[model samples]
Target: MTSSPPGLDLDALRKHLDDALPGLVAGPLDAAVIAGGRSNLTYTVTDGATTWVVRRPPLGHVLATAHDMGREHRVMAALRGTAVPVPAMVHLCSDPDVLGAPFYVMEHVDGAVLRDPESLRALGPERVRNLAFRLMDTLAALHAVDPAGVGLSDFGRPDGFNARQVSRWRRQLDGSRSRELPGIDALHERLAATAPELSAASIVHGDFRLDNTVIDTGRGDRVAAVLDWEMSTLGDPLADLGLYVVYLGTPMPAARGSHDPVTTVPGHPATGELISFYAEKSGRDVGGLGWYTAMSAFKLAVILEGVHYRYTQGKTVGAGFDTIGARVQPLVDRGLAALPREKG
Candidate 1:
């Protein structure tokens, strides 16, 4: 008899699965929290012989238009055979009565999530470099997928996407302003004033990075699955690349016990090289990334602010949240520094 993890009711989940997916639960359920996710709450649940991953919103202070279960399920379900590898969706429970919040279950992907420099270093430089390029190639493949072809023509509005991102993140900042974030407002204003024209619209994974994916080291360092699609939408593809670079540049705080940034690892490709490779692979202009990088920083800063707010309210579900607040200001500064000298 295993006790349920926080924010998940094992009995409720078991009952729902029994009703919706008959005979799926062979035995009583056991669940545990999956760390490393700073935004959505992820859990691994097992019923003796079978296992699956479950994603749900945070406990309290969930922002509007965020942590959408249906959106996450739809995009992944539609991308089953595409070049972009995603976990197989099992079921989506929108009836909050099951988990107190909408949640979806998916097959548990088996692979390594190279989140720290030490993990990347262990692979030696060659494998690390291959993995990085594979990531870039995967992003390009995702960008190459046509929305209308995948029945996602209405996934999002691509026109004025950058402008909407600026306004949306600003509103997100407002929704979670527990403390003053210096330079955040100025960054937002700068982003609003200089939002670039779309550099080509594609299925943008709002948070694209190495850790956000599961690498199948057994398969010659192939990407087994790309996780964390909570922010996926039809928008500027450069936005994904910009955030990927930001992750490469930014390291987690020491207090959080995370290792150095992945960029410092030997064999990791240079930022410029990766960007150029994406340009060559995707056939889209990679110019004017400076503005896109700044926009990514602003978006990340607001996201961390939301997490910090939830931590303050004691609504966060896992560890590593104490230091999240410390990362917000630096992101704000990065956004300001990366802004183009002249608006595009």
Candidate 2:
């Protein structure tokens, strides 16, 4: 008898797959949870020889609008032949009865998620430098993709996206405010007052960072796939750039473990270099990057605050979220500081 995993009902899943797509799984399945806390719950399942990954919403108190597996699966499927490297989507199940929530399956791509500076340092400065530039280049490629060409013309409303993002985040913050966060509102107001003119609407990976991507260390250290697309939409491409820049400079919290701050690492190009490189590569003027950067900061602060709220409610799984809230104020401050200079 094959026992179910902590977060998955193996028997039901196997049965569902067998009925949906026969001969996919030969026999029983073994499953284990992948440690990505405070968001979606990921599982690795194997049926003797074949391995696959499954993504679902958190255990309880999920924000329905935020964790849409169908949306993630659709974007990955749409970018199948594009420059953006995404996992091979296998199947999508929307019937909540199957595994208690909607879930999707994809081929498990083997790679490392370089989280902290120490891990990046071990790979040496040369590799880190290459990875950083590659990261920028990848974003450029994504921005350059034609939505209509890729069957994603209606994926999101690009018109007034910046304003919508600002309003959307404000509502999210209000819903998740467990404690007082000084200057958060002021930062939001400032960002709203000076939102930049929207660039061409492109697929924005709401959270694009080094850690969110999987790097294949052996295959010339290239990005294997871009994961976690729950916040993705058709928006100003610079919004993605702004968030990436904030992640580059924000200090990793002690309680909530940090990924290698690749931008700070030696040989890795400075934030300015990245911005310029992206501008040159994409042919998009980035004079208003400072505003976007401030918006990014505000956006991230709201996200972390939500995570902290979930943590307080005992709704979060895994570690790192204990001190996640502690990082919110600093992010708010950083966003405010970025407003005047508007520099990346």
The candidate that wins on lDDT is: 1
Error of 1 at 90 (Å): 0.6
lDDT of 2 by residue, 1-344 (tens): 76775557998899999999899998689988776444788888999889999998877766548889999999999998899999999999999999999999999989988777776777888988898999998999999999889999999999999988898999888888778889898888877887666777888989988878899999999999998898988989999999999998975432123444556677788999999999999999898888888899998998888888888888776667777887889899999998894456
Give the per-residue lDDT of model 1 (tens digit) for 1-344. Answer: 68889989999999999999998889999999988888889999998799999999989888887999999999999898999999999999999878899999999999988777777888999999999899999999999999999999999999999999999999998998888878889999988988888988899999998888999988899999999999999999999999988888898422234556777789988899999999999998878889999999999999988988988989888778888888899999999999866545
Per-prediction TM-score: 0.97, 0.94
Best by TM-score: 1
Worst 10 residues of 1 by lDDT: 252-261
Locate the minimum summed-lDDT window of 10 residues in model 2: 251-260
lDDT of each: 0.90, 0.85
Q: How well does candidate 2 score on lDDT at residue 135?
A: 93
Model 2 regions lying over 4 Å from their true place: 1-6, 252-260, 341-344
Query: Cα lDDT for residue 273, model 1?
Result: 93
For candidate 2, give the lDDT of residue 38. 49
